[model samples]
Target: MPTLTSHLTSHPQTAEAYTRATQSAFLSLAGQGRLPRPVLSQWLSQDRLYAQAYVRFIGGLLARLRLPVAKAADAVEWRVLRVLKDALDGIVRELAFFEDTAARYGLDLAAGPGEASENSSAGFGPNRVTEAYVDLFDSFGARHGGAQAASVAGGERTLLEGLVLLWATEKVYLDAWTYAREQGAGREGGKTGEDLDGGALRREFIPNWTSEEFKGFVDEIQGCLDEYAAAQGGEGVQDRALELWKHVLQLEEGFWPHVNLQDVASTM
Candidate 1:
């Protein structure tokens, strides 16, 4: 059975986008501990905002999944629901991780430019890329029936699309972080040498991201998406997944440039 993962990999453009994202300079420099503190602080702040939105995104998806499916009592549906529940729990832990990271790095959680504006798309301050990503997730949630909505509107198709987006986002994140970990390990053409002390990023952040537990969560997300995509087989499904895969890559690529410390400093 061809999973959505297989289908996505079949698309050359999708594969290329994923490759580019994994190999991006942001990840490379971040792993090497070469990014300035201000830049990393800015990036982490934006990510914390994104993480908050992601909790809502997963909540919305869980709400959609709870609606009665055509196969009401299917074990697969139950399994997916359990997976989503576990993922929500995991996000809670992830949020705590971000909070700890911020504290350790002395990053002000509320320091970003848009923090004062409650009207911003993201309730927290968000850079443009973060705002755009939040809007995309919000639109999907609104279209499919938001977290508090009593009835799901867009149905299975919407659920599938949301799942694709979730999977793609996690996939890119895992790959990018894994790439960073590898680079930090001195595997990428001697980027991090043995002589220098491995900085907090290499010793702390990379380990947190590349841990076995985190890898397991990433795998669980991938499996859930693959199972759902395989069950919802059709020509249109692959196309939709591919489209979402590319969109996620584009969003991720756009996010890195916003972390440029030099650019941020130049404006100030």
Candidate 2:
């Protein structure tokens, strides 16, 4: 049987969505250097907010971990905690990167949803999709589900679930940028990534997103997730993993500068 990640990527239900999330029209246009500046700004702005929520999401997972008393060699908790810490560090750096890139490119970090074109609707601050993403993050927090029963802890948004989420997001992101790096404006002729998309995308963003270090981080998280899944083997685990995988893929597919998600932005 395939690993969970491989299974999700290949499963008929998730395969198309995974492809859409990684090889989207938005990314394709970006690869071709034909993406409009305003469209890019809109996505960038929403992404900044998403990154902010990610910090809290990782923190929640860190807090929920119940490390064993003994400091066993290479304990799963230690590995999981380290990855979460790395996630925090990475996100902090990303926020700063966002600030620098936005200023350098004169792109508005607060660009409204659907602000891509004049005909598209515009709204202030975070869009519906962004808020929805945040909601999902908050749902995994230690305090989620209100009742706070010990039983509920493992029932709703367990540590395994949150870890899976973290892995899924990072996995999708790495693959998405890998796609960009291969065919983005950075390719072709003697063009360097810095030479295209005002240096924000092909150059800065794609390189950062597709870096070997980032790949290592993603791999570590995947190992951690798989380890936890195996250690926590039980009924409903696979079902929950599959459910969250599909959910994240769907959200990712919507997160792009997508026409199908225009209503999500407009309705907000």
Candidate 3:
């Protein structure tokens, strides 16, 4: 029998979206050393915003969790709490890393979609794709019957679905960067970290995303997700997870901008 997560990826449409998201032309550009500085800035800025929203997203999930009593280390609830805590910690560090890297590279932390000034760090606020991600994160917390959200059945989404979403996002991100790493392995000037846009991505960010520590973190989330799914057992739970997985794939496919029209992704 396929696991919940594996079943989520079994759908042909879901698999295609995952491929579009993970193997986008954007990653291809980063690997080939052809990506422009403005595109990188745009992506970084949107990522920063996404990371910011992730804080509240985790908060919602934490609220939904019912922690086990002290020393219940083996409980699925305990494992879920630990997974969430680790996610929170990782995002905090990731946000700081973005700040430091942006400052060092002089890339615009405030860059937005459009013919953005590659030299200017202040462009605009969050773009459409970033806001869409924020909205999804907020959906876990949104009140029932809200204009922008309808996910709430009783009050908020189930912990099983939330864990599924968490797992899906991290899994897609890890695979996407891993693909980029493979493509960018031996490009000219990559070692010097100055090939394109300060080579922050091809050199620094890509390796960081594909790092052992990050990979371990992704694995932990997957383990936690499966644990929670099994504990929640039932065909219904599996169905919910699969639906949420498809939603995440759609968002991710739209998250990474298209290759040639990098800036255009943000506006839409």
TM-score of each: 0.78, 0.86, 0.87
Give the Cα error of residue 4 in candidate 1, in Å. Answer: 1.2
In order of lDDT, best first, we have 3, 2, 1
lDDT of 1 at 237: 75
Q: Give the worst 10-residue stretch by lDDT in candidate 3.
A: 114-123
Candidate whose TM-score is highest: 3
Predicted candidate 3 versus true structure: per-residue lDDT over 132-202, tens digit per residue:
77887877763422433455232347667778878899999999988987876666534545466767776
> lDDT values of the candidates?
0.68, 0.75, 0.76
Candidate 3, after superposition: displacement of residue 265 in Å?
Answer: 20
Q: Which residues of candidate 1, in runs, are more than 4 Å off?
A: 67-74, 113-124, 142-157, 187-198, 258-268
Look at candidate 3 and tell me the lDDT of residue 231: 75
Q: What lDDT is reached at residue 62 by model 1?
A: 72
Better of 1 and 3 by lDDT: 3
Query: Which prediction has more favorable lDDT, 1 or 2?
Result: 2
Ranking by TM-score: 3, 2, 1
Candidate 1, after superposition: displacement of residue 28 in Å? 1.0
Give the residue spans of candidate 3 off by over 4 A.
116-123, 142-155, 188-191, 261-268
**Minimal lDDT window, size 10, model 2:** 259-268
